[model samples]
Target: MGATQKMTIFKLCILAGAALVGTMSVAAQAMTPAQTMLGDAPSVPKNIVIMIGDGMGPAYTSAYRYYKDNPDTQEIEQTVFDRLLVGTSSTYPARVSGYVTDSAAAATALATGVKSYNGAISVDINKQTIPTIMEKAKALGLATGVAVTSQINHATPAAFLSHNESRSNYDALAKSYLTTDTDVMLGGGKKYFPVSLIEKFQAKGYQYLSDFNQLDSIKQGKVIGLFANVQLPWAIDDNDKNKLSKMTAKALELLSQHDKGFVLLIEGSLIDWAGHNNDIVTAMGEMEEFANAIEVVEQYIRNNDNTLMLVTADHNTGGLSIGANGEYSWNTSIIRGVQASPDFIANDALIHDDWLARVSLNLGFEPNEDEASQLARARMQGKEVMTTSIKHLIDSRSNTGWTTGGHTGVDVQVFATGPAASLFAGYQDNTDIANKLISLLPKAKSKSQSNK
Candidate 1:
């Protein structure tokens, strides 16, 4: 009947990036699990499913909702987040040194309940390893797994699974997986792990799946899926079927076998990538993919009464702003008509004289002679320049505005449903997210205290 009784449920967190102002802020703390507010509350959660939308921001979701709601406009036809919206969380890292936080720090804060330095992964600015929620879940005998659209060793997921002073330690980060007996792992980034180490994993009884078809036949036990050599393609070009829904479905099916339940982190990693390009088509496509994954997770929660699902973003990306050129109203019809992302167009733009013409074909608007000239000039300059030009061209065509291709300091929304989901309401810092989740788990002495 009391609040503590509700804390015993499992948690599924899907980090969708939409804007909300953060109401509270806090300094970084050691990974000390908060003592139970209600002493009678259970410490163990049956399952925790967290899916982080890497660079999703408020404008991203706003545009998605508007476009979806206005058949002539939205990126997603519908989303579970519409009904489950909770609150927002501040994304700044541990210190006043900077306001905007990078993926590593934001994710580390979410994973360890600590505000780490900009590039730190599950480690504080002091360079000490901070124990993560996933680690705690695993230590308590709960199954742990991660399914992401990024390389398994990418910063966001790495913050949950590895600890390093530098997030760029791809080799070190990837190897850390061998040391941790995580139940299931899936994503791109085969290049990060060596052939020898991957072989060692198989020898250790880890089932390695290299494709979705291979993933389809998975029956049980620990799994490591490496679907690409690096980051997977945008959701629009996900012709190979490495869909987020499939990844989440497979992860849920496998992780649910644990008697103690599971803690699985599924990341819509490409959302950030799309944001970096300011590719609205790609961003919306990725949102749809993430939304589909949420739909699947929602079904899981429906069948399983004890599951708590949380969705939030690490940081907003691309400084995306809808209704560009001071328009009183924006048109969703443009977004609705696009068949391919600018990233795809940029790639095809190369090796063709009429690439802008091709872009018009895919985007439903043709560039003027001056715009086409700029694209040709950019193509002559290099890939980076050409890509920028392509995105700018899309911006010109669709009137989608962006301030930056990098991450922003804006607050992001956190949506939740299930028992104890109300604990996540209000303006909290990113660390509060991990801290709240930790409170639901059995109180353990702080890792810092352990050394003492």
Candidate 2:
């Protein structure tokens, strides 16, 4: 068949899949009362927290279950995911952008309930601004903010707070955040906000913080904290492993003070970075950190019945698999022994005289003669090659498999809790998540009503 014919066939397959999904959704809704959609019910939430585990696919969660499992126990222990998983979400962007989605398009759909071309942030396919859930919450007199491990202006958070034709317009996104009326914004990307711009934010009474330690000192009011130059340090390498969790706690504390409640977007953003690098150690560490954040939110929801929390991913990255190369088992023990990220290990070894010692020490296991030779050969090639080699070796040891460094056109898992969470159950598209969230938000006041 010609290329055009193949493309037509692929699109047909996608349409057929979508039809099946719709049918399954109907079947799910008919299954039980707990799965019923509560449209405009009295149980509307006063607060909403949407947590995005960027690039986290089903496989990642499944892998995490085993990674956190206790070997001494006969049955595998269930994590927070097993307890609250509601359904799966298809993450395809607009038809024009094809099946697989980038973070920007996925975030746009999640933020605005509108699909857009990849790289567009909160803008429709026609390059016009679409209202985001955060904007809507602000309009309704509720507080709104975003907390992520990535730079606050990165694709996911940027989509929630700003409108831009391109996600790469980092400077523009940062500037836009100045007037977003967002109550709290925490993450990295101090470089994007120059002294003058930060002063403007200060002039507007936003308490700007550059140090992570300062997060706790401010007990009230609008706050913006930028903790790193770009993204924060990896979970495995950081002094505070619960950094995302801490941010989530602070966001909840600050946003909840608003009388009208709040809308907070918390993203485990570095999970995508680890996936893109095919670094299993870092991926697992990021997963653990993300889970910590989830626990924080889950507890908050248990305490606050008026809050709704939804957790989903933008798309699956690295096509992660549990076993590889004809292996029948994955060795979580090996992964647990990894003390640092592959890139960190590789860089440390390059400057050391005893490269094997450094490598073995970081890996927490001595390499065999053959493995040592492989490491030496990679070290000879240079830092970048050594990093890849280290990851490959770790993957081989742990039997972790990755099909690609880029994202795949796969359905990601959705988890929800609190009032109206059941409405998120069953098969749905990414935009459906945004649409449902938008539906639950309180109506914005008219200008004349505000004047009155």
lDDT of each structure? Answer: 0.80, 0.92
Name the top lDDT candidate. 2
Candidate 1 structure quality by residue, lDDT tens digits, 36-91: 11222233445777878888887877888866774544354545666666689999
Best by TM-score: 2
Model 2, 63-133: lDDT tens digits are 99999999999999999888778899999999999999999999999999999999999999999999999
Per-candidate Cα RMSD to the true structure, in Å, reads 10.1, 7.2
Q: Please report how far candidate 1 places residue 147 from its true position, in Å.
A: 0.5
Question: What local lDDT does model 1 show for residue 107?
Answer: 94
How does each model score on TM-score?
0.85, 0.91
Error of 1 at 316 (Å): 1.3
**How accurate locally is residue 425 in candidate 1, as Cα lDDT from 0 to 100?**
71
